[model samples]
Target: SQQGEEDPQALSIQEGENATMNCSYKTSINNLQWYRQNSGRGLVHLILIRSNEREKHSGRLRVTLDTSKKSSSLLITASRAADTASYFCATDLLQGAQKLVFGQGTRLTINP
Candidate 1:
């Protein structure tokens, strides 16, 4: 499994602040996706940006892709305490079964 690894295993920030997380993968991918998990609940897809795309944004979330570096970064602007959660990056390999391999994730905490 060509899974990615996220840095800064944990992070804490004040409400309304911005949070950034990085992800690095071991293999080429067809696309990359970001997901948010609230506590022990199921993960919810946050964004999906293809290999051909450089960057993407949704609401306060921004994602950047760099195939050359085999890495990606997710940024959350104006984060709220409600946004406190674990963030993971999954890579969809172009070949093989096209399954998603997830990273260890960054545990984010927003202090109110």
Candidate 2:
């Protein structure tokens, strides 16, 4: 798979705690995207970082990319119970093939 791996396969946190996860890839990429998915539902686009960008932020979400290390991280600040979801990182590595591959994902749970 073009996507490498994500650490701490599972996470359990309190509603007010922060959650962070890391993603690594094996191949070069034009862009990397982070997504959130609730149980039995579709994925929600959280943020996107291009090859040139090193960091991005949206609301309480923060994303960082380190091309030199071929790695990325996602941080969700001031987490809420509603923020509990499975987070994934995706990238299209086929060049002209136009296919996006996803990592296995980090399951995050926020307790009240």
* C-alpha RMSD of each candidate structure in angstroms: 1.1, 1.3
lDDT tens readout by residue for model 2, 11-49: 999888889999999888899999899999999988999
lDDT of 1 by residue, 12-105 (tens): 9999999999999988899999999999799999999999999999999999999999999999999999999999999998774947999999
Error in Å for residue 68 of model 1: 0.5
lDDT over C-alpha atoms for residue 27 of model 1? 82
Clashing pairs in 1: none
Worst 10 residues of 1 by lDDT: 1-10
After superposing candidate 1 on the true structure, give the runs of residues whose Cα lies further than 4 Å from its correct spot. Answer: none
TM-score for each candidate, following the candidate numbering: 0.95, 0.94
Name the runs in model 2 displaced over 4 angstroms. 94-96
Q: Global lDDT for candidate 1? A: 0.93
Cα lDDT of all candidates, in order?
0.93, 0.89
